[model samples]
Target: MGHSNVSNFVLAVTVPLPSLLFYLSFVQKCDGDRWENEYWTWVCDWGRLHPLYLVNVLFFLNVDILFWVVGLVQQNVWLIDPYWTIIPVLIAHFYSAYPAAQYDLLRSRAALLLIWIWSARLTYNYFRRELWQWGKREDWRFTDIRRKDPRNWWWKSFFVCFVSQHTFLVGITLPFYSIFTNARPWNAWDGLAFLVCLSGITIAHVADTQLHSFVARNNILKDLGAPTEPLLNRGLWHYSRHPNYFGEQLFWWGLSLFSVNLGQSWAVVGTAINSACLAYTTVLVERKMVQEPSRADVYRQYQKSTSVLIPWFNRSTLVKSKTS
Candidate 1:
């Protein structure tokens, strides 16, 4: 048990350390620094970079530490939760060489690899692009926090924002770890889980494609003397203001299939956390996407018409539809 606990801590630190170092190194260039920094210059700029990024990086890194430490105490298996496919899924499942020893490490590793590739691609794309924006990019959510607080409270706002994002990211991964560690031998549950997760990923891709296409067409129209405004209704988006968010929740919920116990003490809690995290996405990420007064009603109408997380073929009150 002692050994396992230590292993958990070490595992948690893996991604966090690299991410912290990478972001910190990159952010230093935010201030009027040139694209290139000499060896010693790197260290100096890091010392002078925005404390906001530093605080967030530390908070994220510590979260990694806390998870490993908690795994030790609760006997929680690290990177084997069996609930989420975000990060741990790839590490524990696809890379497990000792299939016979670990019971099905090979299969798990394959699944993990697939999930990791998909999620890593998406997350890196989203998070890194935001960082690349430098001051031009403000995570819209941060603007609200900044406005709600006075200028003097920027530090507190920074702390809150950084902690919230870090913690939320951690929560997103919790379900997968729970599933892998607790559930043994893939059963019928695995198929269900796979379908759900795949569905989510596929639909999210579709939504993103459609959104970009819509914008591109509008850009062309604008060039032709008409602006293509923000698309609130079209394709899957017409069904729900946020099909992508729904897909995200569905994917995590599916991943949780591996770890859930219909009656385990943590079973319900894990499910609830997975569900709540999706809700948080809707409230935090989706609601703020629009600002026009005229379109608010359309958004509200679409929200009422569509299923929030579950997919449906069309707008139906009896069932949730993904394709509308």
Candidate 2:
């Protein structure tokens, strides 16, 4: 409690939750045409949609319960980060398995491939930080929130962190469901969606790589008894305070495009809400940067001079140009 050790837990806490969710949803139910089983008739009660909808809800609810229990017992609320990285893959693969009359398998394949690439990059980043190692802990953002209200942090973390993330996951994944069901042939719109998604993935990869390099260099400097530098302002960091976050938000919006082009216009609601959530996340992260003792002043300048999330023309450079 004196100093928050963010990364100090076993991989057991992180790995099993998603594996269990997958087992419950896909593996366990895969015994010989279970969807056609008669039990769903009673449970679904002749709803237009199948019982898998209910299963999906229960699956997430189970996930929440698991998170809350693990969070309370381990006293580590950071366990959910890995799940965040992989949930999209789970949702995409799950929905894509359901049959459609003229199912665009190619489109689903493209979406899944892009999502997997995104997932792989994020998961690698998480592991590279040694978060999967025992004693490795949660992100500082969650730790800071807990520190703010220690007495009530347990319940607050449950609702604010776990529940909020669950809601966002569900909302953001709606388009995947739409894409799976809509069997429209590949068109120019699909091509556009593919290009947008590819762009997002590439942007995020570059941003993450630049960030990792900066952090590693700083660590090396600190270890060698040299002066550590200020926050990163080069590469993608120069244009936006959170280029990775911007790329992530754009990626989801691009996925939403597939649904929209397929004529599921309502899917835009999910994309819009998800975008707002990412914006809120950016605000929270910036708030943390402004409050940190070491980072506050320098980060304040960065925040003032750079776009908060979007990558726009560098304001600092523009000002320097005008001044000269």
**Which lDDT value does model 1 have at 202?**
74
In candidate 1, what are the lDDT values of residues 53-84, reduced to their tens digit? 44344445654444334433443222322113
State which candidate has the highest TM-score.
2
For model 1 the TM-score comes to: 0.58
- Assess each prediction's global lDDT (C-alpha) against the native: 0.51, 0.74
| TM-score of each candidate structure, all chains considered together | 0.58, 0.84
lDDT of 2: 0.74
Model 2, position 166: C-alpha lDDT score: 73
- Find the candidate with the highest lDDT and give its number: 2
Q: What is model 1's C-alpha RMSD?
A: 15.2
